[model samples]
Target: MMSSIKRLLIGRPLQSAELGEQKLNKTKALAILSSDALSSVAYGPEQILLVLITVGAAAFWYSIPIAAGVLILLTALILSYRQIIFAYPHGGGAYVVSKENLGVNSGLIAGGSLLVDYILTVAVSVSAGTDAITSAFPALHPYNVFIAIIFVVFLTILNLRGVTESASVLAYPVYLFVAALFLLIAVGLYKIATGQVPPVLHSPVGTPVAGISLFILLRAFASGSSALTGVEAISNAIPNFKHPAPNNAAKTLIAMGSLLAVLFSGIVYLAYYYSIIPNAEVTVVSQIAESVFGRNFMYFFIQGTTALILILAANTGYSAFPLLAVNLAKDKFIPRMFTIRGDRLGYSNGIIILGIASILLIIAFEGQTEHLIPLYAVGVFIPFTLSQTGMIVKWVREKPAGWIPKLMINATGAIISFIVTIMFFLTKFPQIWPVLIFLPIIIYMFHTIRKHYDAVGEQLRLTTCEPSFQIEGNVIIVPVAGMTHVVENSLKYAKSLSPNQILAVYVAFDREEEKRFKEKWKQWQPDVRLVTLHSHYRSIIQPLTKFVDTVEHKAREANYQVTVVIPQFIPKKGWHNILHNQSSLLIKTFLLYKRNVVITTVPYHLKK
Candidate 1:
């Protein structure tokens, strides 16, 4: 019944050979892996202005330079990851690259960092998506966390159905978001160029800021770097692409990066030109849309699509986390459960874990994107730095064709990424320390898991062909309680296991009951010898346990092993369990310490 339910929920079990069927073409791959990067433009520019506005209206203009800096870094990441795709095409993300080129410890740290970042991605995306809705309609703000949790749960179920199905369902929204943003940008640009730009005062109060400082501008750059969080996803999941996987993956990476660059640049320019301020009641994007389209159908259309793409951005994490987990599992750094795919050819365990973690974060933070935004971007850069650094080492050591330029590109990327990581850590120290603390703990866990697997393999390894411990034959013992149908069933099962050797034992607290049971058994001619042990006290378990110990001793002496079969009645309703005496449980508990004695239970279900 459980298997039936699983099959119904996630479809039938897929054969290993069917993996190719799950491979995605370029278009679907972009939708599945690029959603996170593409969706960031919805809020990335606003993150910049939010920090810049802190220094009063005078600092708002600096958003352009900060965005330009971020754009430069983004371009560097794209080029570096393009090299990553070509060199290590077998889905070599940070963990794989670090482990291969750097040391095992570096790989574990990268894995842990990426895992945390994926969790944050889901949390921030869902919260921001929920906030988008509540910003447009304030009446729903109170249930923000609840709405966010619903979105996570829905995505969880959709992803469990399989990767292809999820990509197909979610791909349309990303395109719609892209079209809406492009239209908004074109209109905004045409208006600006034609001297028809609208005024920017949505509220009576002008944009507020504190005094301008270099530290403030750097902080704004670090904040806006949230856009770079999902850039490595394509390089991480190159294996998901169809034929010519590496080439297709690199092309998709370029496509995603190009789209992100254009959309982000256009949005930042419009926001700056319009002098748009981040509104508490609505989003900067929403304000830009309204100014360009004036609360028309297109305004609401852009708003709806923005919310959808933000929510679907989480699908990128779902796609990458499972693959990363499988990589870690294959290396024996984590449990083997993550290596097993579900009926839908998806990593079910990894997907569920991501969902639960993200949901808890949403609950803890009350679905406020600002509170989560500070905690974001820090985990992302940890892997970004490590992956690029590992690639530099790879190029230097392997000396492949054009290794010099490759080394130079990756070296530049690594240094830039490391600087960005430090900037994020220093700027958001209060919110960032938890991730630092979490990294060492995760590394420690990986070492412990490897130790356990090593120890288990040593014990299970076979040196000689001879049996570890020889056993001549089997001795089956059935514990009977009177001549009830359950006892008869257990005796039958014991006979099936050991046809020629079966012993029935009865433990009785009442002499009168024992006498009557023996007489009745003799007349029944059951062809089984019965040994009745008398218990002076009213305890029914002690004598039965001692009998099993004696049987095991006798079997050892005779070069045999003992098997005890006990009968149990399973009640139809769970509440009916309280009505039983639980003698079988007591007998099983005492027999747990018997080394060579095998205990089995035959359950007879009660109809009523």
Candidate 2:
């Protein structure tokens, strides 16, 4: 039933040979990878105003300049990542570049930050999209968290379906959203140019710098910096693109960046001219749409599409996080499980982990976009600075042709990104202190995971030395709960192994039950010897494992190996298996690490 449900949700399992066919073209790649970045235009401008509005009315105008600063930073990142794509086409993005140039520790830091950034992107983007929905309908205000989580689950399942399938499913909506915004931009710009729109004043007694300080402006910029968060995704997931993967990824990055710049600038510019204030009740994009198109179909259209694109923006995280995780896993920084793809050739573990983490974050922050924004900025900029710096290091170390020009671009990006990050920390220090602690914890976890993998590799390393131990015939132990056909079949299977001896052991809590089992065994004239152990506390696993240890030690005294053969009832209905104790599973799990022990199962099929 579970497999049926999984099949229903994600479709049939894809063959491994179909992996190449699953790669997306540049157009679909843009929609998938740029969704997060493109979607940010919906809230990036609004986040800035939310911060600046705290200062005063006129400080709202400061948003224009701050947004321009964000745009400049955006341009730097696009160029820097293009360089990264050019260098590492196979794609590891920040982690690969940082690791190769700045060393393993820096690489781990970059990987950790990107992982955190992707999680926050999904949380923040979905919440912001939910805000758009609530703003338009006003009926969904109470269930925003639930709605956001549902979106995450939906996206996760789509990704698990396959990369190409998700792109095909989500691409149209993303393109529609982009076109809708471009229409909004065109109309809003015309209205402003024709003097039809006037600046809506938030305060009548507004004065510049009256209640605002430099810190306030910087804080606003930090909030808006989320606009640049998803830009690195393309480079990270270059392998997801079609033929000429790096070149295709670079083109998609360009396309996404262009859309982001135009939409973000236009929204901020419109908001500045119209004096849009971001409120819990209404998003800034909703405000702009109402101001430009009023409560007409166009307004609803913009709001609906904005909400959708924002939610879909999380696809960016869904796209790259798994790919980035594969890179970290390859280096043993994360679990090897992440390195394995699903039946659909997607990194199922990483995708599922991202979804679960994003959902938790949504619940933790109560689906408030503003609450997650301050935290989002930190993760976004850390990787930005590191990746750019990594590129600079690459230029200086390699000295490729035209390296100086490339170095200058990366250096400027590194400086800009670093300054913005530091400013974010200083301005939002009170709110983002938790992130400072969280980041180091992630990095430490990375190191701990790497050390464990390293240790496992060390243990598994082959040596030229002789074998450590000798093995002879098996000492088979058959565990029985009662005299059933299943136990008899298991005993026979054990006898067929040509073992030196076979012992059928039973742990009895009641004396009457033990006597009945022994009588039954004597009547049957079973070939195997019977051993009964009384457990006063009625503990099964502990006593059973202890007995197995004793038997194995005694067997080791001679040149013998221990084998435990257990009978399993195969229920017709899959869910019926859960009704039983499933002691065989626990037994196998416990005895798996024993060096000289072999465990096997004999199945007894149920008719019903």
Best by lDDT: 2
TM-score, cand. 2? 0.95
TM-scores, in order shown?
0.88, 0.95
Write down the worst ten-residue block by lDDT for model 2: 199-208
List residue ranges in candidate 1 displaced over 4 A: 1-9, 12-17, 198-210, 464-467, 477-482, 496-559, 568-594, 603-608
Candidate 2 yields a Cα-based lDDT of: 0.86
In candidate 2, what are the lDDT values of residues 200-319, reduced to their tens digit?
443322344677887777777878887888898998998898888988888888888998999899988888888887777988888888988989999998888888888998999999
lDDT tens string, model 1, 1-608? 67788777777778888988888889888887998988888788998888777765556667777888988888889999998788778884888888888999988888888887889889989888888888778899999999999999999989999888898998899888988899999999999888797544221223444576778878888888888889999878887889899999999999999999999989988888888888776888998999899988988898999999999999999999888888888888889999888878888999999999999998998888877776678788888888889998898788988888878778887887887788778788987788878899999999999999988887778863546657889998888876787888888888887877888888888899899989988886368888889999877778888888888898889889899888998998888898888888888888878788898989998898
Residue 133 of model 1 has an lDDT of 88
Residue 238 in model 1: shift from native, Å? 1.7
**Considering every candidate listed, which one attains the maximal TM-score?**
2
Candidate 1 residue pairs that clash: 54-210, 55-209, 55-210, 56-209, 56-210
**What RMSD does model 1 have?**
3.9
